[model samples]
Target: MRRMYFIFLMLCSGLALAQPRIQLSPPQAVVDSVFFTETTTVRLELDYPGVALRYTLDGSPVGSNSSVYKGPLALSQSATVSAKAFHPDFEDSPQVSIAVRSLKYNQPLSITNATPKPAPQYTGAGLSALTDRQKGALNFAATPKAWLGWETDTLRMQLNAPEAGKVNMLVFSLLDNAGAWIMPPAVVKVYDAGEQIGQFETARPEPGGPTQYHFLEVPLKPWSSDTLEVLVLARQLPDWHDGAGRPAWIFLDEILLTQKP
Candidate 1:
């Protein structure tokens, strides 16, 4: 019969290509480059070896004992963690993602809780005389003791705006002496209580290691003040020595001034 109808159509096309392929094994975590503080712990791994594995956070869904995680999973906050795997007949395996952050360290220059009543005066002019690595850290007396002039140096800072809208935001963190120096693309000016309302520059240096820590954001349109001024015109490093060669000390942390209900 024509060789049994060509071997019964090649055994029904080899049982329709043996349909049954489920493979997935890639999802692990342990992330923290610096977020300061919030919470952190995420660990996950899968091959579906025995099936049954579900997860979701920042998406929601995965609760039975709610802590099964076989190998590597930790998350604290600022998230997006996902997972999927469940075979009973095969039909549910396509969702894997891991992204996390949260070490919470937002100091933005402490002013000891200010609402009003004399709390804005730190003057300016290359302010840097609290070393020992800045004592116990955390200091924001309305932050504005500025100084980064080098190469004909001449920078300033003195902002005291307790009220008045528009100034959006400004957050800072920088330390150098071989600790956090990689911010090069100058031109940053935002003075309000002295005039000028905006100016921006800095974008390049995103591959870190070694005393690493960088975070900066600027945006201003609203203005109302008690006093404010910050100017940095930097450029002077022909091996600008430090630790004795002078000129090599820039440490400003958590200096925030916000207004946006």
Candidate 2:
């Protein structure tokens, strides 16, 4: 009986090693690198006509009971996405794995000095609109939007602290609509108790791969303060880009705060 078991195991290993490997449509997809906002709907595609695709989101191995790839996966939280191709003639394609992180943040209690022209359409109760856990995606603007628009080059806002604590980072989410001429802020400066604490700059458009939505995370040394002020200044569009000379509209949302653990 022992000899038979050993012989069976050796045959199975040999058969597994002979299977053909499967590939994904987008080569950029990899493990632990891709990040998506919670509102993002990611579509996975492969060109293998005869091969069926099976996927799992809870770190489980794909089986006959697993989900079949039919449409885009909506990521509402962090998850490990794994998938593979199957065909009767070919061995199971090597599984592709990736970690998709859902973006969620805790924002400031109140914001002052926004003065966003076309005031935030949905300001609930007070100035806590930006951080109200509401968010907007690429389209379907107006309602259920977490964005505030300031048709200017500069925006200054004061933040009220949740409690006395040490903070080291500030994250701002902005929109870049090339058609609408909405651009990103180039400089971010932080002030604590009326004195400038730190300032950071972001790189402009890359040679390629400029994103429609941009997130700016500025790091600051650990500082204790009850209130912090932020200034966002944007550079005007060059003659080459569209909507030049007019005020560079800046849309902002999610003033996330990060503190050292």
Q: How many residue pairs clash in each candidate?
A: 30, 0
Q: Pick the candidate with the highest lDDT.
A: 2
lDDT of each: 0.45, 0.62
TM-scores for candidates 1 onward, in order? 0.26, 0.57
Pairs in clash, predicted candidate 2: none
Q: Which run of 10 residues does model 1 get worst, by summed lDDT?
A: 129-138
Tens-digit lDDT track of model 1 for 1-261: 999999999999998878766554433433443232446566555554666666766645544333345654545554556666665665565555443434242212223221122112332322332111221112222334431212223345555455546447654445322432323224557777667777766543233222322334466766766565766543333243232222223344335554322
Candidate 1, residue 203: lDDT = 45
Error of 2 at 64 (Å): 30
Ten contiguous residues with the weakest lDDT in model 2: 25-34
Q: Which stretches of candidate 2 lie over 4 Å from their true place?
A: 1-108, 116-126, 140-144, 206-211
